[model samples]
Target: MHEVASQLSADLLGSGGLDRDSGLRPGAARQEVAQRFASVVADIASGAVQFPLPGSGGTSQRFAALRAVAQRDLCLARLVEGHVDATAILAELQEPSPGPTERWGVWAAEPPGEGVTATRTEAGWRLEGLKQYCSGAHSCSRALITATAEDGRRLFAVRTDGPGCEPVPGTWQAIGMAGSDSPDVRITDLPAVPVGGVEAYIRRPGFQHGGIGVAACWYGGALAVTEPLRSAAQRRPDPHTDAHLGAVDMQLHAAGALLDRAAAEIDQDPHDNSGSARLRSLRVRAFIEEVCSATLCHVSRATGAGPLCRDLRHARNVADLSVYIRQHHAEHNLAELGGLVARPENTR
Candidate 1:
């Protein structure tokens, strides 16, 4: 597993890789991140590295791989996770497999804004409108995008290299996770192939499983943010730092154990036959999000502003994680979870 981490780090940050010095401009940094992501995707296509499918019994191994990538670069991990997730969604829906070297992204973010709308043309389906938070916007060759259709919300696969899809420049002005290259994409009547029926994307069992996979990435990012504090404690040996470290350990250890148990349960019930996947995913994601949030607090409180000012990697990890974990809907998700727990069916 360490070797896997090292290999991923090397692939992403070694040699003609991401400029980690913090001196490079955002344009250069975004280009480098995209290039590295493309290289990693090529490697995956070539069988040099492979991620296990969710609920494949090797789900722990899959999470480990995501963690390894997030530990090094959350931007890359975001793209990698999206690509792997696209493949998994396609497989689960019995859609045609992606091309050998095609890099895919899942652009299902439905935040309040003008979103893509799907129309059935004489030829086929066509999409239009602007989709926000399209990560790997300029880098992905293909994408599984969700758009509102005549019937309901549906998922569609579309080629991004075509003429109709354009990534709106300057839309993503984020300081954190900027290397993800997420931008608002304007889909202007782009041809698309519908992957599944209305609402199928969220209705699948894999939807819950994928949410946990994201939690796995959050766990890894938390590990990355905790690194400087761990090193500082090792170097200085202060009681105050040790106390923070102890708290971090407790949080991370419990989070990891929960993740492991969740993975095992996923393997045991890949199809959600036991009807617990939704509740389990919500709990795992919420728990891990809290753990990561706590870790950031502990590390920052223990280390103060020095690391944020001095260490580029640590600063980036801190910033990236701060933004990434916001994907967990916090109070809204908690309310939903509460509703589930209060349900008569769930009580039994």
Candidate 2:
């Protein structure tokens, strides 16, 4: 799977087709990359690819796989190299595929509490107000935007455009996942096709499925950072540093188990919501952040500031992971999951 992801990434980076104008039209190379990514994900779902390592920090492997796929696709679409906006690439994928739409939309509305709004307009539907923390927004061609209609009811999927939407300038600076480019966006009088009626959009199967993909991405990034730490641990002789490595390893393992369980629940029976799945996701994310942050501290403390000056991989990883960790609803979702778990019915 890693090899496949690497090939796809290389193909995308090497493909001269990626450029500013490349986003203006959907080209074969972009489609091919998307198709390959979809195939890899399918394999994962089908158990063709193993996820979550057996012992500690297995979740990192899963996250690495997910990131490789997403990053490769984004690269193919020229999103990472800065030639194209991430939102546009995502919009292209949102277009209907040849098979039944296995694709799920991952959306996050900003302000963390207010719902999105979509109203009918002469030019399709006018989407007004803010959508906070939309990861892949720059690349997502279609999204199930949560908004309230003029009538004050929750509505969704109003206007959709890849390039038409622009990032709220300068909002996304953070520590990790800088390449994610999950920036704020505003839609004005754009056109769209409703995937389902307002209520149905929120209640769709795809909605639940979306979380798993994100979980996978988080897990992968955790692995990417941890691998270096593991290497450092092997080389270092200090017992104090070794003890920190042990703690980081344990945290990673626990997080991976949570992710694996969540993935199973999502694949087996998506609608159940059991609240456990969501809780597991929250657990994994929190644990991942903790472990990664600690690893950074340990490595920096042991290696000293010398490494920081030589090459920026560690710093870059820290920065990227920090930003990526702040996906929409992260804290709020965890709180909601806690609430649900505390409820009597959720105990079952």
Candidate 3:
């Protein structure tokens, strides 16, 4: 936990700190983030970072514990954009992934177009066409790409350093998460290795589980940005600022409580391959999203634009949270939650 915290602070709160235009060009910024990832990979590879898999313990206690750590170190996640999501995907794959030195990206975005495809080659599997939202494109050494195969959608792990792979420039345009470098990746028959069969990526209980972990990252970012407001309220004597601080504090407190409950539930039924994990993940993500949104608004209102203009770390965190929380699917997710709630299965 301490090592992860060190890596996070080193990457995000570096010498000069980050700004809106920090990683727009993708040169020095790319190398800086890659170094940070290398540090994390070193920890994971050396077994310093121990994350419990399904059924690691008698119950599922370790999974929830690791998740708590994820939430605490979310500032690093915010710093590097969504690279941690890809890392989580790699760690959670059915097949044992490569060593920690080999970074990974989760490239599963399918827009209205010819998504990535998997082709059988004499040597092995090959990935063709384009994959969208390839975060950590330049930095990550490998990627787990979802592509259409003969039967249905399957997950494929391809080495990003291969000849046929390319990270398209001028594609990523988000000012808030520019450091992520999530541009389009062009794959021209890059040799690939299949991780699992059709729909295995989406069908796994860990998929839903991972979504909540992402919400934790967002919650962490919100916490970082809202810290200034709390400090102001503590030192100042303004009723208006105090009121906003009180409201945001209540929100974060409620979200923290919910996160704790979700962690406990996850530990109780560690190996719930059933759809029950969906409910817990949806509730956590949605509630945290609400709390984070409220935090951003209240902090902005209470502090005005002075901190945003002067304080680089706080401003960057606020912008990053704004862009990062959009991972929430909004109505579609809510509708899914409603459907899950309607299903009266395993009633406790």
Backbone clash count, each prediction separately: 0, 34, 0
Q: Write the per-residue lDDT of candidate 1 for residues 1-348, one digit (tens) a residue.
A: 233455465635553224665324667667878887888888778877778788887787778788887877888889989999998899999997778789999999999988999999899999999999999998999999999999999999999988999999899988788888899999998999999899999999999999998998999999989988999999999999999999999999999899889989998999999999999999999999999999999999999999999877788888889999999999999999999999998886
Pull out the clashing pairs in model 1: none
Query: Any idea what lDDT model 2 has?
Result: 0.48
Best by TM-score: 1
**Candidate 2: tens digits of C-alpha lDDT, residues 1-348:** 244344334542333222334333334334443454344344444555434421223433443445564332332221221111112223323543222223323353546554356778776766666676655444444455656676544434432445446657766553244444456777655555554454554354433434444544554555555555567678877787677678767776776666556555555554544545445545555565556566566666766665555534444444445555555355777677688679887676
Q: Give the Cα-based TM-score of candidate 2 against the true structure.
A: 0.64
- Give candidate 2's error at residue 36 in angstroms: 13
lDDT of 3 at 91: 61
Model 3 — TM-score against the truth?
0.85
Q: Which sections of candidate 2 miss by over 4 Å? A: 1-64, 67-95, 98-107, 112-116, 134-144, 151-164, 171-176, 199-201, 273-276, 328-334, 346-348
Q: Which scores better on lDDT, 1 or 3?
A: 1
Expressed as tens digits, the lDDT of each residue in 222-329 for candidate 3 is 777787898898888799999998998899888767766666666666557454787888888999998989999999999999888887667666776788888898
Q: What is the lDDT of residue 37 in candidate 3?
A: 55
**lDDT-better candidate, 2 vs 3:** 3
